[model samples]
Target: MLQAFESAAFAAWPAQQSLDLLGWHLRLDRGYTKRANSANATAQSLPLTASDVQAIENHFRRSGLTPTFRLTSFAPIEDSDRLLDACGYRACDESLVMTRSLAGFVDGSEIAFAPDAAAWLDAFAHASGKRGADQAVHLEILRRITAPCAWAVHASDGPSPACGLGVLVGDQLGLFDVATHRDHQRRGLARMLCGGLLGWGARRGAQTAFLQVVAANSPAIRLYESLGFEIAYRYWYRVPTT
Candidate 1:
């Protein structure tokens, strides 16, 4: 699972495009570059320190980039939160890392994976409240998906309902960006899409699959936990001060 997490992080880093390491804290230029995004600090065997945080902040400031930090799988590090508080970095949000073993995932039904980019974007916009310039972010995501990487999307009848994206890395699957249109909620489209992704991962020999969800999203958390996923870790995001 650790290796899989690292692999996913590295794969995502290129999209962010550049990175710098400060002990355990990875600071990315140009809005938290891709390389730094891949740093699974908490997943590492060693612990991170306050100096690491300072180093990353220094690197970001020197690079003339806004200081953004993402702590992945960042469990308790001795005085980690204190360091952030000392450095003027405030907690932005927290997310839960949920994992599920795929030993019993079965391919029960065929869910139509979205093949059209326009349709996928429409669904994304409806679910995420992101439109206009923010929609450009989907282009990078589409590039990754159409690169023929392992991804799946299920649409509803008449129009596309919700969408789920999953990426497979070695023996694990990373599920990301599961969104459902407001009107399409309560119909279990998200579950079907998630189940389909799990099935896809299982077929490819993924023993476990994991995803991150906002800690405040109780519905999503409940769904995942009910599907046999457990909270593996909690991560927080923060931005460094000048």
Candidate 2:
């Protein structure tokens, strides 16, 4: 179900804008519960006009939901930030679409899969430090990885201190929800978790791996770069005004 959401989020672009909008709702509603949300809208041409902005804002306002817009940095808009500002929108955070080639990568020792749905949810929430739709979504992901995929955790002195989830998607392995306990930082646990997932991906005939990261996360960016992942695109967020 998590994979379905991700795929739907990606596929909704240029196909089903309303469904795409709902996916954004699921993501933000899960995160903020109610205070904030975002939406991704696109056009075939560049340079959105004031009227275009108003139209989008009206659409959301009529739906009784606040509107926040996300546009790619590569979008052909001149002074997009200014346009958004004029519409009462502000830049939130920048994020990158990163990809890595997985050819010739080798799988390392296997990590044990959690025994049941409850255990998986517990580990995921423990690693993430919270609960809600994100946890529920990951739980669904585990339920779907019944094939050439693996999920696992690693411990320092006791039971695993950090956990990671990964899956083979086509010719690529995708890693998500890699987290370490607050007490486990600076111990290289994140690296170890990620490395294990990369190894798993390689063994499963994946030729590449991809993940999204907030651009402001320097440490993660550095780690991924060191691991041979390169920035493929920059995605930006904006909001529409009523």
To one decimal, what is the Cα RMSD in angstroms of model 2 from the true structure? 5.7
For model 2 the local lDDT of residue 101 reads 82
- CA lDDT of each prediction against the hidden true structure: 0.64, 0.61
Model 1: worst 10 consecutive residues (lDDT sum): 31-40
Worst-scoring 10-residue span by lDDT in model 2: 8-17
lDDT of 2 at 141: 41
Per lDDT, the best of the predicted structures is 1
Residue 169 in candidate 1, Cα distance off native in Å: 0.7
Clashes of 2: 2
Clashes of each: 3, 2
lDDT by residue for model 2 (12-61), tens: 21121243322232123222312124455333334557776666566566
